[model samples]
Target: MIVQTLPGRRAFIRENTRLQAPPHTPELSLHLADEVTPIWRLTEEALEEIGLPPPFWAFAWAGGQALARYVLDHPDIVAGRRVVDFATGSGIVAIAAMKAGARRVLATDIDVFCEAAVGLNAEANAVAVDFTDQNLLNAPPPQADVLLAGDICYERPMAEAVMAWLRRGREAGARVLIGDPGRTYFPKDGLEKLAEYQVPTTRELEDLAVKRTSVWTLP
Candidate 1:
């Protein structure tokens, strides 16, 4: 519907969300929608009616929070490396990679709104994170020393496609890392668990106040 003008999107983000630190990664702040925010009450159908994308960029999902925490705690994983953050909702992982000393980070998402969301978030954290609305799965994975993805295994088809693409990136020499909260579609094999956490979340978003999430690497 062409409703996502950059200025409007930025204003929407600022007006509907607040800059807050994620529970698991308190060192970084992001513009996130909380229970008190108007956006928090919006359903997918309502958002679609208003020509807005699902508000994935408006919250710090458990997977992204855990992955960001892991990256910040173990900076060596991304330090001095070129990184790509796939499905970078709110750009939490990308910002973490930059804070962890990555040489550069390209945050990619199909949702056009994320460009605005990530820009605001990077500014909040005082970090530089490049963002694109490109669907990275369509091309050869960009050259990267580290590739990060989080909370992307919700739907079956998307999970399969993303995992396949991540595997290709791993085969091409990029170290691929994923953070998940045991979604039904998340693969049950062929990954190395690096860390696990009882990530604090909101029941309104995840139907639970705490989620057991984990960070995994594609070896």
Candidate 2:
């Protein structure tokens, strides 16, 4: 508790978690918490003592897993392009883009701890991925050839905000891709399904142990 610095937060992550491959994306490995409940409970309690939010950076969610798998399979989507992974938790999709031979990859998240997590995961995967702690929600979409977002539609407001920003990215001529595990706020219209996967996840993270996640592009 009380992790005030980036190093302190990184150390807490390293101590509480282990480097392992997510079940749905075995090609890449990340430093992740072992059980969802322990870290969830700890972060919940630490909210008062540490002023840290829930450790979303510690788990590979179903949407990220399926998106990573899709990227690895469809290298042409990112090959030689500047890619941005928005709301990158655990940096799974950004790492996958790098491994798929992207010219560059930038992973962005609101949590500063995610910078450390993304850096560690990039090093482990032998891919160079840049990280940013800025929220980038209200700002203009940064220049990129492609934008990847996974599991971003969990809440109504967040889903609406990011969708609008992502649409701006698409209008600016960047291909925007979203991965969702049937989140309620996902705009069912105007998205072309690029790929789908049966992503295995812990029940602690979702209602089902196996989630059918899909990758969609605005076209």
Candidate 3:
């Protein structure tokens, strides 16, 4: 069943799928559901409406949907855990973790703008999330119990670095979970698939080559 929205709820905003991206460029537009929304264009607008941020690098990739579906389907994974959304772009996974009952949620990103976005999105969802401008490339936070990442392994060097960090986190007994939508450099070994979901991508915002995506979980 589709998740139902609460009436006059200032908690979460839903993005309509029928909205079109702008012409002549790869930048897509979104509609915000909040009154003091921060989206500058249609792409940002849509994500603001959905309590998310416009795609940081590529709009319409829909990484948030993949993570959100996972949370809605399996709240048990995040229930009562201290979860960290590493490389949180628009705070999608972090928000989902909060919705799933994580004891505390921290959304970390290298991008400074993501901090503002996370704060705004968290306020929009009426959930508390610690948004920080820390980079996980050096190391995972020492206090993280569950490390969650989505759509982070697209580039080669970055993917390698992230995988190494994840391996270390796993060795340290932390439950490391990754939500990848078939990105180019996603690791293919030693990972048990937890779930999968079909997510939408936009040719107008990104390349037509990666129009649609499938979300996968690494155990």
Top lDDT prediction, candidate number: 1
> Cα lDDT for residue 44, model 2?
58
Q: Judge candidate 3 at residue 35 and give its lDDT.
A: 23
The digit string of per-residue lDDT tens for model 2 on 102-179 reads: 999999998757888898889899989988888898799999999999999878999999999999999999998888
Top-TM-score candidate index? 2
What is the TM-score of candidate 3?
A: 0.70
Better of 1 and 2 by lDDT: 1
Off by over 4 Å in 3: 1-60, 206-219
Ranking by TM-score: 2, 1, 3
lDDT of 3 by residue, 1-219 (tens): 121222211122233222233121112232222222233354443234444444462232455556656775678878998888878765767877887789998888864345655665566566888877767667555577788877777789988898888777777777877777677798768787766655555544445534344444445
**TM-scores of all candidate predictions against the true structure:** 0.93, 0.94, 0.70
C-alpha lDDT values of all predictions? 0.89, 0.89, 0.60
The TM-score of candidate 2 is 0.94
Query: For model 1, how big is the CA root-mean-square deviation?
Result: 2.4
Angstrom error at residue 12, model 1: 1.0
Q: List the residue pairs that clash in candidate 2.
A: none
lDDT over C-alpha atoms for residue 125 of model 3: 64
